[model samples]
Target: MNWQDQYQRWKNDQDLEPQLKEALHNMNENEIEAAFSGTLEFGTGGMRGVLGPGTNRMNVYTVRKAAKGLALYLEEQGMADRGVAVAYDSRYQSREFAVETAKVLGVHGIKTYVFTGVRPTPTLSFAVRHLEAGAGVMITASHNPPEYNGYKVYNEQGAQLPPAQADQMIEQVNTVADELAIAVKDQSEIEAEGLINWIDEAVDEAYLRELKSITYRDDVKRDLSIVFTSLHGTAHNLATRSLAQAGFDHVFAVSEQVEEDPEFSTVKSPNPEEHQAFEYAIAKGQDVDADVLVATDPDADRLGVAAKKADGEYHVLTGNQLGALMLDYKLANMDDVPRNSVMINTIVTSQLGKAVADHYNVTTEHTLTGFKFIAEKIEEYNQSGAHEFVFGYEESYGYLVEDFARDKDAIQSTLLACEMAAYYREQGMTLFDALEQFFERHGYYFEDLHSLKLEGTDGPEQINAIMEDFRFNPVEGAIAVEDYLTGKRTYLESGESVDLNLPASNVVKFWLDDDTWCCLRPSGTEPKMKFYFAVKGETREAADERLKQLKDRVLERL
Candidate 1:
């Protein structure tokens, strides 16, 4: 059916929610068309959308449908007997969604473990593995605005379902012909029947126990002064507790954003990717002369840091810089660690991390642009015993040191960052000075990210057009192009194309002369097209300028 048919169905339905019916009655034809034009597609990260009525929205009926489909998929996988773990963030209707998911799965006779309250994404991943469940669900949109919520699926391995599995799940989600027909048990009935169990402190304690192993130097934590903010999400107590447990004495929390708020009252966006999220943390850091400022996104899966620079002002470190520092520290300190240790990072991340890994004589592997890919790699290594999993990170402020959880952990990252600061202080050098030394030894590598926001309706088409332009037209200053979707690299000069072994994704990267490169990929979690530029030069300033030039040249085309 077309938009008109869906709109008519909504208008004629008696079971539709009242507010949604009122909104639909008030909407114009164009608005109605947009709302019912298509079903919200579930990507590798799962479904996320505005909380309202429509095929494009996330609501109870939609949640029921997704859960029913997920249940069917799990049953087919012979995982119905293994059960599932469920967790949620502090988004509006998040708890409702979590309970609703449990109800649907329970009605299917699949046992479910639901958190008693809001929790982080990594904890949910850990719960799946710890409980020996077949799968997991996290009801969150990560750092998206309060208006949005999401549903994420994890496999038995504790990683987000890979692309192929996600496609299978999506097919199941699409197969539910009637949303209202999805089976669900009464909440009280499910609880009484013991089909749904509530998990609380035990999971948290086990997760923290795993984090203790991340400490490289016990002495460094004692002297580190760290400021951390959770941006009004679920990470407040967990991060602070982890820091103190790691022996960090002087740690401050942002008072205003410490409490759980679905609206994320303090900051415009809860995302760590935005520098504005660090405003409160930065001010507190300056007031106390903190060694570093750390902020976690909602659900505590991503980490961002602000450090005091040589110029005596606080500067936010990009994901790449922080990843480099942590990679170096983790690899160098692995004196007694397994010799075949491996570190994983995304393809779009800074090549500087690869350099650091090479310096430590550790293998660095590149994956598709998500922490799930990194987690998948970790599971692979753990099973094969061919490589020891060391560290994993991505360019978007996501880092995982210990695989206690199958996802990034801001709590673990915060403690480790503080420890690194203390260690550098004992060495009589600041992190900024250490960064400079690193640049001098390795060639100066600077990276810049440009996000082009294209709002609703035609946004996806516009993003696709932009990607198509690059795929067809040879980049002016590029010597080669790596198209991830086709899993091949095209060399312009030699007219040679080599197969790239990584998983397929809609990403195009240009490799230029002089160690300069640019990459283009649509944001999986937002309505934006992201461009990444990396440049190398003799000095940091020169490299930054070159990076800016490259960004300007590519963005102009967009």
Candidate 2:
């Protein structure tokens, strides 16, 4: 059906939800068109969109359709008896959507273990494995804005659904013809039938117990004065509690952002990737004379850090910098360096980490953009024993030190960052100093990311046009091009082609002269096209200049 007809159908429905009905009555022509243009795309990342009453939004009906699709997929796989785990963060309507998902699954005779309250995304990943569920569902948008919400599905391995399985699930989701027509049992009815199991502290304690194993040192100075903020998301309690339990004596929680505020009133955005998100934490850090400042997103799956410089100013570290720091620290402190140990990162990540891994004699592997790909590699290593997984990270402030949770874990990363800071403080150094040392050794590797927010009906088309333009048009000074969509790497000089040996994705990377590289990829979870640039030079000034030139040149073409 056309969007106009769909909008009218929704407008004429007598039994429409009151909130939706009100929203429909208030929407303008453009709003109506945006809402009914098409169904929200449910791919490997599951569904994420603005929370409203529309096929394209993240309302209860859309969520129910997703749950029903997952239910059908599970039943088809004959794994319904194994049940599914459900968790949500502190976003608005997150709990309601999570319960709605369980209800839909329950009506299909599928058992569900649902968290009673807010939990981090990584904890949900852990619950899938700890409960031995066939799959897992997380109601979150990660670090999206207040108006946004999302749904992410995970497989039995406690990892987000990889491409192959995600394709199957997407087909099932597409078969769900009508969003509003899916049936769901009442919460009470599901509870009485023993299909809904409420999980709380038992799982929390289990997850915390497993987290204890991530600590690498017992004698590291725990007196590191630290400032932490959850940005009014789900990690407020657990993050602070984990620090205390780890014997960190001087930890200060940003009081303004310590509670669960769905609106995230304290900050403009809850994403730890942005420097603005750490305003409250930075203020608290200065007040307490903290050795380091840490912030986690609403779902607590990504971590961000800022360290006090010698000049007494706080400097926010990029995701790559923090990843390198953590990897170096972890490898240096390991009692035995296994010859077969390997570190994993995405194609868009900086090569500085690989240099760090190389120094420790630990191999480094590259995966696609998503953490699910990294988790897949970890699972493969676990099964074949070809390599032991040490650490996994991406360029988007996501890191997983231990594989206890098959996703980026901000809680454990926070602990380790604190420990690393404390250890460095004992040597009269800060994280900035440590990072500078890495640069001096690794040739001043600098990196930056540019995200273009091409949203709405024409957004996808425009993004595709840009991708096509870059695919055929060779950039100046480029030596080779790696097109993940074609799974081929072509050398410009020799016209030789080779396989990337990685999963096919809509990503294009350029290898330029002077040890410079850049990548272009669309965000799976957001309506944005991201440009990642990295360069290496003998000095910081040269590296910074090269990085700016590369970034400006690439963006000008767009």
Candidate 3:
């Protein structure tokens, strides 16, 4: 049947959920088309879409279908008995979705472990490894708006399902033609059947125990005042406790943003990457004259910051700057890093991190975007023992300090950020001051990211057209252009091409002649295109000016 028939069938079904029925009643034809055009496509990070009552939306039926697919995939891999750990954040119906997932997996005779309350996405990764589960599912949309939710899959090793494995799982997901027909066992019966486990304090304690590896400095004076906000997600208790345990006594939580509000009452958007998310935290910091401010997304996987400068002025640190600062701290404070210690980052992240790693004699490796890739690298290194994974970061405020959690962990970064801030404070330096020193040492790396949102039916097509144009005619003065989708890097000067030696992805990056570069990629989870740019110069102003020129050159073509 067509989408209209599907919609009518849903509306005609006697057992249609009341909330979903009301939603269906309110939607117009265009809205229904938006919700029924197609299934929410699952890619590298699984599927994410607006929540509503349609096959294309993130609803119970869709969740059940995804869970059934994952269960089948696990059974095919012979890991079904090992089970899957499930978790959710503070989004609307997140708990219900998690329960539905467990119920579907249980109906397939697969054991499931689910958190009792809201948990961060990273914990799902950790719980999978910690419990020796076959896979994991996290119900979140990262930093997307409240209307959005997502389903993310993780492998047994506690990383997001790599593309190869996800392809197979998606094939299984697609085979289930009718999502509404799949029957799930009752949640209450699953527990009685010994197939469902409710986990909470135990996993939290174990995760916290492993977090000790990230406490870089123990003797730093906690003289620096620190402010942290969870952005109405899941970081409040974890971050504050982690700080207290690390001896950072002076800490304050941005009370307004700490509570779990699905609406994200305090901010327009619950994204930590945006400076606006820190509105409450910044206000509290200014009132208290705090030395630093930290904010984490709702799911507590991404972190953002605003550090107080010398003159009591606060400056928001970009993700690139924060990642570089942490990398500098890791390398600088170490007596001697492990032999062949390696730091990981994405292609679009700032090169400043690589410079710091080089200064400390650590190898730097680049991967396609996403924490899962870095997690896979860590798991690979653990198996091969070729190199020690020291730190992993991205330009989107995702950072991982320990391999315990095979994902970007904001709670871990929150405590470490405080520790780093306090240590620098002992030297009479703020994070902003340390950032300047990094510029002085690493030649002032300037970077910026701009996203163009083209929603509705034509969005994806428009994005594809833009990318096609880039492939044929790139920006001027490109020293080299690396197309990850084709695994080719073309050297414009020599007319030579070589395989990029990375997984195929829809990302095109151009490196310029004067140590400047820009990359273009459509966001996998959101309806948008992102442009990332970086430049280096002897002076900060020169770097900013060069960055603007480089961005303008690329923006004109797009």
**Residue 407 alpha-carbon offset, candidate 1, angstroms:** 1.1
TM-score of 2: 0.98
Tell me model 2's lDDT, rounded to 2 decimals: 0.91
Question: Candidate 2: minimum summed lDDT over ten consecutive residues — where?
Answer: 212-221
Ranking by lDDT: 2, 3, 1
Candidate 2: count the clashes: 0
* Clash pairs (backbone) in predicted model 2: none
Q: Write the per-residue lDDT of candidate 2 for residues 1-558, one digit (tens) a residue.
A: 888988988888887789999998999999988899888889888999998988888999999999999999998888999999999999989999989998999988999999999999999999999999999999998888899999999999999999999999998999999887889999999999999999989999998888787778888879889888889888877888888889987889899898899899999989989999988888898788888899999999999999988799888999999999999999999888789999999999999999999999999999999999999999999999999999999988999999989999999899889989989988888999899999998888999998999987689899999999999986677999999999999999999999999988899999998668998898777778999999999998999999999998999987
For lDDT, the strongest prediction is 2
| lDDT of residue 215 for candidate 1 | 81
Q: Which ten residues in a row have the lowest lDDT in candidate 3?
A: 215-224
Give per-model TM-scores: 0.97, 0.98, 0.98
Candidate with better lDDT, 1 vs 3: 3
lDDT of 3 by residue, 1-558 (tens): 678988998899888789999999999999998788878876678989899999889999888889989988998899999999999999988999999998999888898899999998878888999999999999998788899999999999899987789899998898888788888899889989988999999998898888777776667786678898988898787778777777778788888877899999999888878888888888999898898898989888899988887677777899988998998887777767998899999999999999999988899999999888888888889889999999999999999987888889998888778889888888878888888888898798899998999998899999999998997788888889999989999998898999989999999999897668999999888889999999999997898899899989989876
Least accurate 10 contiguous residues by lDDT in model 1: 216-225
| Alpha carbon lDDT at 377, candidate 2 | 97
